[model samples]
Target: MPELSGPRSGSEVPLELLRTPPPKERADAARNRAAVLEAAARLFAEHGVEAVSLDAVAAAAGVGKGTLFRRFGDKAGLAVALLDNRESVLQEAILYGPAPLGPDAAPTERLTAFTDAYLDFLLPHLALVRVSETASPGARYRIGAYRFWHRHVAILLASAPDPDVAAHTFLAALAAEHVAAVLPELGEQRLRAGLHQLGAALA
Candidate 1:
């Protein structure tokens, strides 16, 4: 139960577990968990989530299957960990990047920047993105990307003249339509155009 430190690095465990240890975890457990997450993310990004197995992740991580299961609980849990790792990076970008994204920009301007950044961020990671959508019931707790994007847009809307309606409308209008269908089928330009048009209309 390590707390995420700043915009740099740390673990994503429940806050309540911060002061409590299971009483059985060894010193190497932390290192092994980190390796498993790294390897799983790499394999899933390269071969798609369904294509990678628990055994493959363990092997790629240079750990045993028992260790992988013990660390993550199961394959789905491992996917959640991999996604959480990437989500942390995106969170860092939003919290610490330049103006319009990080802070100090107008609502409309921030909204525009967010759309552009989200499109760029989501384009290459379609594999993990799709897997995340299909992962769990309360996926946002693990995959914070969607919630982050929504909240960014919502914040921009709230800062504007009319917050309540605008924020809800903006989210609905901008959710990916045909672009997030899969890989290669949707180009960046097309997605960008859609986002721009939606942003303009909302503005």
Candidate 2:
């Protein structure tokens, strides 16, 4: 798999996949992926995610439709690629940053921090997140990112009455649609407060 480098931070994080060398790609193939991502981001920003299609993305990127299809299986795949960098950053923070989010923090504090950080990430990338989730009803739960988060939360909740249930329930509260649906009416402040309350209950 071709890997893209994400922004680095001072703290060292154990991201073995990211740290390891990826299989090399032909120069042209690399260029094409970059082109497609850039074009898709521009088009999505200007026309909105719902208005853009894979065909349009191919045209804008000046790549063949077949190339686009091979590069990204669908719009959801493209959205995942677009969000990869941001996701990596958050992952780094959780794994290696200071207290509250990193390993040094207490379980409750870590859980609270994760919820807040995840919500912060969700707001700006709501469109892409929604696209990924809507690709299939259970798609979000199956993604690699979701698995990582679930594991992290489960570990944090290890001492809880039921770690597995607590972790899943926590993640359910942060699902993209669940948050997006209430965002307009509740606003970020209220929404975050609600999530904090939920986290507190879990803790």
TM-score of 1: 0.69
Q: In model 2, which regions exceed 4 Å deviation?
A: 1-24
Q: lDDT tens digits, residues 44-69, model 2?
A: 99999999999999999999999998
Worst 10 residues of 1 by lDDT: 1-10
**lDDT, model 1:** 0.60
- Candidate 1 lDDT by residue in tens digits, 35-132: 88889878887888779999999998999999888777766567556656555655555656677765666666767777777666556665555555
Candidate 2: the clashing residue pairs are none
Candidate 1 Cα RMSD after full superposition onto the native fold (Å): 7.4
The alpha-carbon lDDT assigned to residue 124 of candidate 2 equals 86
